[model samples]
Target: MQTIVIAGGGVAGLELATRLGRDLGRRNKARIVLVDSAPTHFWKPLLHSVAAGTIDPSHYHVDLARQAIDNHFEFLCGEVVDIDRAGRTLKIRARLPHALGHESVLRYDRLVLSFGSVTNFFGVPGAETHCLSLDGVEQAEAFRRRFLRLCAATSGGAPRVNIVIVGAGPTGVELAADLRHTVDTLVRYRLNSLESPCQVRITIIERGPRLLPTLAPALSEAAARKLRELGIEIRTNTAVSAVTAEHVTTADGEVFPAAIAVWAAGVQGPAINTRLGIALNRNKQVLVDEQLRAVDDPFIHAMGDCSAMQVSDSTAMVPPSAQAARQQAIFLHRLLAGIERAAIPVFRYRDQGTLVSLGEYGAVGMLRQVIGDRYLNVQGAMAKAAYRVGYERYVMANLGPVRMFAQMLVRWARSRWLMPVKWH
Candidate 1:
């Protein structure tokens, strides 16, 4: 039997493991094992919300071990340290210190790497070492802790809770809106008129000409307008040369004072990809061909944010988004059933438009017509409704429709009877 090992149980990886497990492992046709550094999985898009304390991540986390049992696969918790391509082996380290102190060397007949990406600091001074990032749950929780402390510090007086976000992409924009929502929620619950109006000021700095650079121009304009109406500041065409403890200095010599600095400017594949003896782009993404196999080795496949699969007919590379990752997972599930390197099919990513949530205030997104090339530009109620539906669809994909409905009911009950996790 071919032993198929998938690393990094992110969105694409988890879904792939489940599908492959049900198809192959259940039938006793193959051995399927999933490896991840984390014991649980939370959708990456919600990291900003988690950081803002609008939602608790633990409530949404899908336990990998539970998933493995239900899906008929095996789960190993580890950080894959090295790939011995000649030996067809993986060197992994225990992801948690509490686990047994041992290094594992596992061999795989087929290997898939979906390890995802990390925050890219662009080598800007202090960006990597100093700024907080929303790349993972721990980091998001850390930011939330600091934010709550800032609110606590302003118990009886006005405090300027200044935040400098060094990117104006979806993560940055979403974070700004959610942070504002968090402060507003705190004001309503903990801070009364006897106190100040949260004293929170957020500034988004982007080197690009506009926010959401890859999005439709009209949609970007709409999002920017909405943000401004909510009293959030935007600085376009502004580049950060360096970050300091108290301020982020612009390339043009201006400085923005910040109580907390966040780095959401860009992303690149994890550093381990560079040492894998495969061809990696400057961004550290494994350069894959049409079939999603590493250019150097057919046994090695890379997916999601870690794989730079070039567009079949265009110069543009596949953008790192949950939509793309989901599409890839579905495509690969059908293609990898044979578990062979021959007669592989190329992956063609579908464009499903974009959705950028503006916290509770509202949302903005452009939905594409499945029948045509046009887009349905959406905002306000329509966009907000669509946003919720998008998440529901994801839940349905991961947990099935019946479980999704039950989960939705639980969330409604919690919101009705219990205060938000921030209060706890």
Candidate 2:
């Protein structure tokens, strides 16, 4: 039987591992091994919510060992250090307690690389050390701690809190809204006071001319209006030239003092991708063929944010998104299931839609394709409900129905229990 090893254990890698483990491992045709740095998995998209205390990580994370047993796959907790393509082997840095580490080399009959991307700081001065990011659980927790400390220190002193978010992308907007909601709740509980006489100051800085630059201009405008209505300051056509401990210096030389600075400007492929000798695009995303195989190596496959695949003649490459990563996983799974290499179909991306959540009661986006057109624009409460349903559907699809229902129940219970407890 052939042995298949998948690196990352993120959304794409875990899904692939579960499907392949059941289909191939159950039949005794192959062995599937899923490796990741962490022992548990958390959806990357919800890191912002976690940071803002809008969601708890305990209810959202899945233990890799338990998931592996349920899905019929072997789970390994270690970070991949190097890949020897010629030798069909990879080195993993074993994580042992109280020691630097010993290396373990694992050979694979087939390999799938889906080690996902990381936060890209763009080398802005002080951006790395000064600004807070919601890249993973650790960063989110750190941000949450800092947020609590700031609130405690400023209680009854400032009329409002000043939070500056650098980026007008989905993460930034969602985080800003979530943070606003959190502050609102905190104020109602008398946990913190706003610095201003009237309202809390939440600023979103964007280098582009409008918010949600990837979306339609009309949608972006609507989102901006909605955010403003919620007391958020949308600063478009602004670039953060540098970040300091106390303030952010813009390209126009405007300095804004903020209690907290969030960097969600952009992201790029992980450092390991650059060292793999694979062909990467300008953004450092590994370039993959239509079949999702690395351009330079047929035996190795790359997916998720770490990969760039061309979907159409006009479009240069597919955008790094969870939807794209999920589709790529499905396509690769089909190919691995005995479909002839040459006969395997090329990847075609399906743009379902995008939804940017605004606080608890609001969201903006489009949905339902207009026949030949791929884009859809939706707004108001209808859009918000649709977004929630879409997220539930995604959770149900990735995690089985039982686990999904349990998660919902747990969330409801947590909300009831934690709402009255003041962290400060």
Candidate 3:
């Protein structure tokens, strides 16, 4: 029997592992193995909510070991240090906890590379050390702690708390709105005894001309208007030169100091890709062909944020997104399902629109592909409902519809009955 090893536990890797584990491993035709640095999985899109205390990660973290057992696969907790393509073996440096239980090298018949991406500080001075980011649970929880401490310190005498978010992309925009909502909710609950009201100000600085620049101009305008209505500041065409514990200096010699800084500027593939000797794009992402195989190596397959793929017979390229990852996972799974890789069909990417949640202020989305080149924009309640369902659908993929719906109801009840935002 052949062996398949997937390295990553993000959306693409996890889904593929679960399906292949059951489909291939159950029949005893092949063995499926999932290797990840962490023992659990969390949706990258919700990191902002976690940072803002809008949601608890407990509801989203999926245990890889438990899934592996139930799905008939093996789970390894370690980091892939080196890959000997010719030898068909990988050097996995186990984490401290896994060192006692796992081996250092794993053999594989086929390899799938989906390690995912990381935060790109853009070589900005002090940006990495000074600013907070929402890259993982630890980072998000760190931001939340800083946020709580800032609130506690400034509840009365600090006048106001200023938070500077660099980047007007979805993460930055959504974080701003979530923070605004968190402050209001905290005030309403009267948790801080430092006066009747505490103000928390959010300022999003964008080098681009507007927020959500990749989206339609109309949607961008709507998002900007909604954010402004919430008293969140928007600074367009502003480039940050440096960051310090006290301030962020721009190219124009202007400095915004005395603010909590968050660097959501952009993302690039993990630096380890360069060491892999694989063909990579400018962003350090592995460049894959239509079949989702690395351009330079046929045996290596890549997906998720760390990979960029060009579709066959079309000028379109698949962007790194949750939807694209899901499509890629399904496509890859089908190719490996009782079919030879050489006879696998070409993978085609479908644009499945985009939905952005604006905390409690509302939401905005664009329906594309299904509507052709032109898109129909939806906002407010309708967009919010769509955004809510988008997550539910991802949950359905992992937890199944029945359990996902039940979890949704539990979350809804918790939000309504317990508290809208968590303080700790």
Q: What TM-score fits each model?
A: 0.96, 0.93, 0.94
Candidate 1 CA-lDDT value: 0.87
lDDT of 1 at 209: 97
Order the numbered candidates by TM-score, best leading: 1, 3, 2
Model 2 bad stretches (over 4 Å): 96-100, 158-160, 192-200, 339-344, 420-424
| Model 3 clashing residue pairs (backbone) | none
Q: Please, what are the lDDT tens digits per residue for candidate 1 over residues 149-179?
A: 7767764566587899999999999999998
lDDT of 2 by residue, 250-342 (tens): 999999887789999988888888888889987788898888889999988888988888877756567777777888888888788764366
Model 3 TM-score (2 dp): 0.94
lDDT of 3: 0.86
**Regions more than 4 Å wrong, model 1:** 96-98, 155-159, 191-194, 339-344
Better of 2 and 3 by lDDT: 3
RMSD per candidate (Å) reads: 2.0, 2.3, 2.2
Candidate 1 vs candidate 3, lDDT winner: 1
lDDT of 3 by residue, 197-232 (tens): 336778899998989977889999999998888888
In terms of TM-score, how similar is model 1 to the real structure? Answer: 0.96
Candidate 1 residue 266 Cα shift, in angstroms, is 0.4
**Positional deviation of residue 21's Cα in model 3 after best superposition, in angstroms:** 1.8
Cα miss at 83, model 2 (Å)? 1.1
